[model samples]
Target: MKYRRVKPWLVAGGCLLMSACSLAANLNYRALLVGVSGYPGLDAKLQLEGPRNDVTRMRGVLLQRGVPAQNIAVLADGVPGAELPTRANILGQLDRLASTAKPNDYIVLHMAGHGSQQPVSPGSPFARDEPDGLFEIFLPRDVGAWQNLPGGKGGAVQNAIFDHEIRAAVDRMTATGAFVWGIFDSCHSATLVRSAGGSEEVRMRQVSPQDLGVPATAMDRATPRAPAGTVATAATAVAPSSGAGSVAANRGGSAFFYAAQTSEPTPEMRLPAGHPKRTSHGLFSFVMMQALEGGAGMSYRQLSQYVLTRYGGMNETRVTPLFSGTALDSAVMGQDAATVRQWKLTDAKELTVGAGALADLEEGAVLAILPTPISGLSEAIGYVQVSRAELATARIEPVDYAGIPKKTDTELKVGTVGRLVQQAMKFSLSVGVDLQQCTRPCAFDAPLTRLRNAKPGEGVAGAQVQWVAPGQAADVRLTAIGDRLWLMPPTLGGQQACTLRPMALKAACDDQMERSLVSITLGSLASPGNAAQTIGRALHAASRAANLMRIASALASSPTNGQVKTSVAITSKGGRRTAYVAGQVPRLEDGDKLLVTLENTGRVSVDVTALYLDSRYGITAMFPRGLGASNRLESAASDSFELEIHDDTLGLERLAVIAVEAEKQSERADFSYLAQPSLPSETVTRGGNEADGNALFRDAGFAEYATRGGRPAAVSARTGMQVFSWQVVR
Candidate 1:
């Protein structure tokens, strides 16, 4: 049952999986585990550790999750009575699953083996489907070397399962209304350039396309191509295959979890890290099994995060796994974690992220850039600020340039993920003025000169802040009328008009309440104000407000989320208490109060901060109310906070708990500075400040709220937030 040197624990492709349950009569749970560790056609250098042990591990996890022994199927080279994992048998099992699976049945398909790619000839019918003209494939035990087609149509690898064909088979099962989970512990190829290190004996699950007969030139031209030889090293066979769970996915009734991105190779390393006889297994599979064995219900998003955390904890930072599905929030049988929206970084020079409007990223928003997903914010190469934003994509430019080496940006490989530090308002306001007061000989030179010479101090709106000469992409146009400076919401010289409905208050509007674009007067310059102060102050407030909003939107999106427990209870005026319904919004009447309990469930101690954000533009730090107080909750400890309901502050109100892993007892990460007095709903003035200047200005520049020195210091552990929001209706 055991062998030495974990070979490429390859499968025909990724498997389709289903969770086991006690209700066998109502829901049928089935699985097909194909693990191949041998490739006679390839050199001994390419053989992987036998996956017999891998299959056993998988089988054990299923049994723990309640799958019946009779329902599980196995196809491997070494397992007795198991059918050989030839391409035919793998497809046959899929066909059986599609044909026999009922509407309510759930299935799990797992494949472990070597994977590579082959080029599709331009003349092949499937050539157009592959952007790089290469078909990602998983080699079966019987897979042969790639050979050119007789007619020169293209090249083909015998016994390799193409990824698209696997997708089609899964589609059939899903169409039957059965939920399918495709869990592959292998990567498509090694497109990543990894010099990152870890301690465990690592075995890669990728075979180079070149070894499979892919033309060297075609491999070079591929969008995400592998090098000459794979990063794989032959290892002796050690194991076998592996879970139950409500993971949501993009395709209806299906979800896919890849051990590595299309660009990287996943590893088969000794799992459970320090086990006395730690067996070698695909790192992704073992960690995932650990999550599923916990028996908590999770969404696909949650499962993806749990696996990622294991990688980080184990110091395996090279491979970046991936997940996709529409209902990532739906519950499945497993654990959950925070959701950080990361996009693939395609270009370092162009500084582009593959996310935009859909992800709510705005121009000028800053992001923490990491060399790998496992890198924490403290390990960021530097920070990037968005330069342009479109519907589904955005472009980024670097800041904190000194954080990285001179040519580091150019060397950053593709697929790096960018993390948001704070949000920028949808569109920054650019001031354009002719300033009739100054001659061409002086066209708005006085105000422009002041702004140009301003320092990059705290609360600066944006570095890209522009004061135009007359035309261009201007958000606000200022004119000198009499002794006063008048601000007009118009496109100077009929150029780019302000896209925001209410140029100055767009960022302040909570909803789609139509507020007309309004202009403002900087008061008479002769009295007390100057063009520089009025324009400059407004810019800072707008920028700050945007940052606060973006941070608020992502308060609970950290990987550290789900580590802490948050529970809510409501107390009636009569002293009776009731558990808060999961998704039911409470309509709080007078005297109704909500109590929140926080429990530290993660590995390390964490400092917790309870924050409240109301319908109006207000953020209040509710816990550790004093500046010097600490809210550190050690592992297994709990903390509680009570919130009073306000009749006037009606609409959607939120209670969020932020927990940052403590690196040292004295370390603290306080965001209390984010707390600001709520702005009155009636104010829509320019310079949208979230502070108590009597009335916080809208659209841009906010009056300084507090002395600004307290931002959290970088820590080795992650910062996590857990939020509970509900409607406050009369």
Candidate 2:
């Protein structure tokens, strides 16, 4: 026999794990996890350690989701009882599944490993079929080095699993009326970079074509030009086998989740940054699992939003994750569960939940004790704050609030569950220094020490600063590349410093207007006298930006989010309001005016507050000018607020409107007190008691202000906030 076909019942865990059904059990759910870590054919620097972790965690997540251990087949290096992720085993399993799939069978294929680009293989049918003259590939453990083809006209890697091959197998499965969801956590657009910057542990999931013998010009021809925030002449890593991911998205029976766009890099780092037990794992994998576990009952699009928003909140504008598929509305199965992760309410001595670090819940995160898994926010008997959190369980304590004073242990019905409400927020920022270029006497040492040792009580310290090794999980990195220093958002690895190019300074003060649009260089900040202040100002900007996103992300989960009816628009030059739409970027002209209307759609009257997040990381409170009918829109009534836009900074900006249930007609939830201004420059430094939790504090902002002693304010879950992003153009 020329080939061996894996029997689903024998090797792939088909009917062996279950009794034979009357006729092919309905929805024969199956999964194939391919995680490649060892690459004998590549350089040692190219080897990785995260794929093993990714596979292990993924298996556990699937098990929790109810996928029988036998139905799931794992192919990873170093994982016991699993076959090696060689090209032959991967294809054999795919063929095995495709050949046996029945109509409506749900299948999942997750590939986590190193990906690269190669010229079309010689003597292969795909040779002339590849219009781009290259195949985007996922490297198997047995993948071979690139070698010269027969005519020397091109080159290709031996044993590299090509895109078209993946498409063919997936197509066969889809043709059988099965639905496939493909997830790729690896990137192929590798811009080879110097390893001198950042911590040494973090690794990008890309292997540059240049690393092979491909010439730069040929490599350029092999891939198209990259869009914004990416280097030119890159392969289509974003597509992850356009045939594969798109099959799930465009085909009638599939969906795909991409870790990054074409030409952009994705990083793998130690997860749960502050956790001592944290080990190497792909950030995308960890993030994906956290989102999936949080609520496996949602649609594909909803799941995508959670990953995107949470990622943006942590790493602004670094890389983007894309989800495409016609099956967006399809519900994911944690084995038929469409509800948030929940634990049955009990009379145990301590309230312990089955969810822990795996669900991304931290110690300070808050949860709602609901009457049932599908219970609404109003049905919450009381709230609980996570007291102790571990991998699989957490201890909860009832929190005191005005409406419900204490934890209600008796009034709950049988089968009640604890629902996730809000994740705990830590207002500290971590910064890392990349000194790959210079020696000990370098100029960055002094400033690094100062910022690394920065305090967190008040003023600039309000945004706490943490120093970490380069390449470790960090919010920002100060990298010294030879003679030039660069300020960059966290990059995946070495060459990703490509994003470190000159960044146009945010719209500055009138005195700095001449320099407003000018691109700033980090090299100028390397001098001794200026290093400290420069680092301080930069950190200040980063802190404010991160906090603003925190407000947008955390409060976005307000139990009342979708329940509150609101409209956001801006009056244009012609005096007509251009209503802002979701999923599209809105733009505002210099003279444009923002118009917001709030309708009390819920059971009780709501206090409305509007905030503006600027490109400079400054936040301004726009509503509740102070105490009146306008302050609290009546339960059945509506109100409007407007703010004029001027010729200020122009870039990405956000608008957040929050409505919190107000039991009384007199008291207002003045969240405007959380308003924080841009550093050393513009914004309102106005009203509200600083020491009080209601207002934004001097340095301790949203997280610290809302949760004074690990307990959040009472109105937290009762509140609904919606944030919008628009481009402020001239």
Candidate 3:
């Protein structure tokens, strides 16, 4: 069944006349913020402590961004003097905003509360189209009062706002050529919250269908169905537009940012009373409000990352935020096209961005330089790397100008202003595993498990092995010795000619008899394949997940940037020897001293922190106490400092050095909190400092940074920061 789209309500003749007169006026900025923390007449289990506070914080951010007080509307539950956020009041306000908006106007609709899903009644208008037999809904303050009403009637659904309703309102606004931004800080699932360690009391804001009078039979009958004209797949969903047109097709387009994925839960937290920033807020709202401070010239993508990095830093991994919109790269907070200005090129190669450490600029970030008068059609002149970054400005060195038009007179010169564009970075690994020798009756399964269970400095941990094969995409794990990689026990079923390639000439290998590199294909194992191949793929998936977890942990703990010169010294009994070559991976014995020389060109005080991820995938803080001295380096005119590595470090280890400018002398407490060591094998540590660090670096913001191996951007302050990664093998 095709549902008819709702039409916008007609304004009175006088109102239309007034609108026409104001068509040429400055673009109006309007916002409708609905935050519900109290559910009257409902179970206390449904109560929240964040929504009321979320609205106040958001309103403050908007006001600070230059939005007039009269242009914003607020409806909150349990807040005196504020409009009540009942179903009727919320829907009425949406309609009013849609009908009154004009071309070039900006409308922001932010909803912070619980979201629920209910079964669509049989024969209901939405049933045939909603293959899942459910309606996504926002629960208003009076939702409890309407729970007892019979299904299939308007009155029964009156208290909850449906997704279609929101889509319709957004559509109407977009039809008038206005831009719309919708932020929903709620989720439909309760299982999406990551429980704090040792705390069973944590809860997500969600309600079941039964709690809202949805019959089990109705929900049971709501079986999944393949929609007409579309192939059904586990990864694909086919549904009618919830209400708005495609993000790109609508005038000026619209964007929707949800605090959590559709299946995940959004969380609210109460900070300790003496916390400096806030007391209670949805985690999303808290991070978002903090992101807005000193975030004047950020694109929607940067804004999203600001929230993501901080959210991840909090050690909350149950739900990832989602963003969908046409203007993802556009400035946030509704800055008009005329108001968008480009950063000026101070030197032939350097583009000076007024934003620095506070804006999240890190060394080695790549940014696209776009021609002035920026728009969707603006052409990029070239790309540049952030060679030097500071608190308020960064020096960008030109990487290339191949994108510039050859016939044009444009030259790399001072005072040329251009917009900078950042691209998202993704990491992936490619390797081939030899499977030629394995036959039908191979009996090597025991050895495979032994390889899998190997510890750091033993067996195959941290070995690089290559494979040569043709036409096969199967995954396999192999152990390397000398120049050849041996296939681990339990040869895969498929027959293919494969050979292991020798290690690259410059690459160094350990003295161990057996070294291995694991390879796994990412896809379904249901296809008829050998048991060994399927098992190998599963192992690969698990390893990949573990690697990502480690990456997140490293990001939460590591500092951003500081310049350093490093060398490895082998203090063997034969004699004290130095392996002091810049940029070379050095091999070492059991008792080697890793010498690091630090330099601070900037005047700001900095903290030097180093972390090592060992061959066994274990992480250890190697600097500060780990290395037996304070790693904090103060600013000096001729500053030169040295750090000595401990003797216990082993295996193929990756060392990351981060230097961050001090925010305040007291902020050292925050670093100490993050530096507290976790179990060597533990991938994630839950603590308040992680969340606090998330907020700190997110507020600092980073440049459009990418690394060759897909390492995550190191977290750091925007000013006077640098990061160096080195490998030391023992």
Give all candidate RMSDs, comma-separated: 21.2, 8.9, 23.1
**Candidate with the greatest TM-score versus the true structure:** 2
The TM-score obtained by model 1 is 0.44
What is each predicted model's overall lDDT from 0 to 1? 0.55, 0.62, 0.47
Can you tell me which runs of candidate 1 are displaced by over 4 Å? Answer: 1-25, 194-200, 221-252, 333-730
Residue 570, model 1: lDDT of 91
The true-versus-predicted C-alpha distance at residue 246 of model 3, in Å, is 5.0
lDDT of 3 by residue, 209-284 (tens): 5556665555555534425333111111111144445443366566667776444557676531112232567777
Which tens-of-lDDT digit does each residue in 616-713 have in candidate 2? 55678887765343567766787777877765665456667777788754566766665665433311112211232422353443553355453433
Residues 1-730 of candidate 1: C-alpha lDDT, one tens digit per residue: 1112211111111211122222233456788888888889887767777365577667766764456777889988877878888899989998898788777676888888888767655565545445544667888888888777776565678878987677667766766667677778776765423211212145567787767766665554543432443322210010010001112112236556777655456666554332233456776777676555432355676566555544432323345566553344555522222234455587745768876643346566667777765567777767777777764468877665435533355655556667766654322334556455522343234544667666653223332354544433233445443333433332112112222112332332322111111122432222221445445554443334333433333332355666788788998666889986442334455577888888888878888888776544356888766788878878899888888876556544566576778887466766665565443322222343333342233322221211133222222227665545555544
Query: Where does the lowest 10-residue lDDT sum fall in candidate 1?
Result: 234-243
Between 2 and 3, whose lDDT is larger? 2
Model 1 residue 394 lDDT score: 83
TM-score sort, best first: 2, 3, 1
| Candidate 1 vs 2: which has more TM-score | 2
The C-alpha local distance difference test score for the whole of candidate 3 amounts to 0.47
